[model samples]
Target: MDDFDMLGAPQGSAGNGIGADEDPAAAFLAQQESEIAGIENDEGFSILDSGEVPSSLIQDPDDANSRKQEVEWKEKAKLELEEWHTRQNEQLEKTKVNNRAAEEAMVSELDENSPGTEWERVARLCDFNPKSSKQAKDVSRMRSVLISLKQAPLVR
Candidate 1:
């Protein structure tokens, strides 16, 4: 009937209260026992003694189906994202090819070492209309700079 024994304390020296009614160990055991008794009387309290679970605790069938559908939707969305990325990469590659072809065409049309004056060659390569007032000024400035560079003496 000792409170310490109810708490599974060792039956020997320690189990016996040190001759005091106000022992802390005894008080703790009394509290635990009262709580356990209260829970046992509750109608909703239960112990799953058997290995099998009761149907009440099982998940609803609709929830399981919804989860399965959600997983499938996520998988479909992931595949769509991957396909979009692949298409974007293909378009980027096509653009690069087109740019390279355009550059090659321009270079073939006019070689940098072709026989012409420096101004003529530069103006033609840049597609500059020397007739335009703004372009004429730019071309004149470029011609002067080029002429000065060409006439400058080699410093050795």
Candidate 2:
């Protein structure tokens, strides 16, 4: 009995009967082809090219546009921030100028109030209105004179 008959298959029936080879590798290949053919004939079965991308993997046009818009928004925001910082610096400079002017004005007023004569300053310190009173009769002037002589009034 042939080897094929011992396996309960007729000779050359182990693979496709069309020029089938006795080699096991060829038989496996033929079996695979037949199985694939059967699958293709079944309902809702189709073969696809391995090189082609699936629909889910393809990039959508709307997604690309949204990404571009996001980049533009970030750029706009950065520009606005820079402009705001520039305006703030300008305002700070103006404030500094105003403050410096006010300080100078105060210094000038203090200089104007300071007496040109030391005697007049001493009279003011002794509570006499040097600019409004008669110098000869002023009691503060006498006190100023005594202080200048190092004989300041004794406090009792």
Candidate 3:
């Protein structure tokens, strides 16, 4: 009435029930009033409650400093992304060079005419991974294979 006390009363109160002991119609009316009051109180909810502008919206309107900081953050992010891409490209190029040299050396090892390059024979004699770089164990096995192949007499 005078205040929105009854109008804003919570739902399911003395007015919102069809129970034999309670009044369903009063309950529904009270619920509707409460909802209407809530809508009116909510900022910018409807054009019905005059110009009761909300205070929160007026408090921190997007100021110049906020906009400037936002732009600065975006620029910083963009530069960081560019630097990341550049570093990624450099690493990729380095890997390509390393792989190319490794492939060439592997091919040479496979070629029979290439002297002292016996990776293919070593790979065949020992169940070793072809991609394993020139490690001590593989080299040791390769020397043994070379020695055995050289010393073994022709048994045709």
Candidate 4:
């Protein structure tokens, strides 16, 4: 009358009640064991093994040429780095000198005690009104003088 009773065991046989088809856990374990066995016997598994470089390619312990080349490259790199540093230091010194000269030129153009002769002459040209009249005329005159100086091209 029950579902288990429909599939009867052999007559007079003492069955373990739980059949092989009904046990999913045992079937899974058997499948896993078969897969593990297959993997263990596989020929491609040797490819997973680590390979080392041949001894011939490695630097010879007694060879001087390899050592000499290494030392030469290191010396070359050191010399190039030193030259770069020297050039940077020279550039920095040149910049400092140029900045110092510019500062000196600006200082010489200014008069602490009294206005310079050029300033007084330019001021007189525009009736001493530096902001409006004098500045405009002075700017034009200064531009002309700068142009002429450039045209003449100082022997630097």
Candidate 4 per-residue lDDT, tens place, 7-51, comes to 675334237665545666888899999999999998642433457
29-120 in candidate 3: lDDT tens per residue?
99999999988788554433566556665566667689999999999999999999999999999999999999998887566666543544
The residue-by-residue lDDT of candidate 1 on 1-156, one tens digit each, is 775466665455454655444678888999999999998899553536685556666657788899999999999999999999999999999999999999998887666565334555444445334566753445767756655544552344
Candidate-wise lDDT, in order:
0.70, 0.69, 0.69, 0.65
- Backbone clash count, each prediction separately: 0, 0, 4, 0
Report the error of model 2 at residue 140, Å.
31
**Structural similarity to truth (TM-score) of each candidate:** 0.38, 0.37, 0.47, 0.34
* Superposed model 1: Cα runs more than 4 Å off: 1-54, 109-112, 120-156
Q: Sort all candidates by TM-score, best to worst.
A: 3, 1, 2, 4
The per-residue C-alpha lDDT of model 4 at residue 47 equals 38
Which has the better lDDT: candidate 2, or candidate 4?
2
Better of 2 and 3 by TM-score: 3
> Superposing all C-alpha atoms, what RMSD in Å does each candidate have to the true structure?
15.2, 25.4, 13.2, 17.0
* Number of the top-ranking candidate, with TM-score as the measure: 3
Candidate 2: global Cα-lDDT?
0.69
lDDT, residue 60, model 3: 66
Lowest-scoring 10 consecutive residues by lDDT in candidate 1? 120-129
Which parts of model 4 have CA positions greater than 4 angstroms off?
Answer: 1-67, 112-156
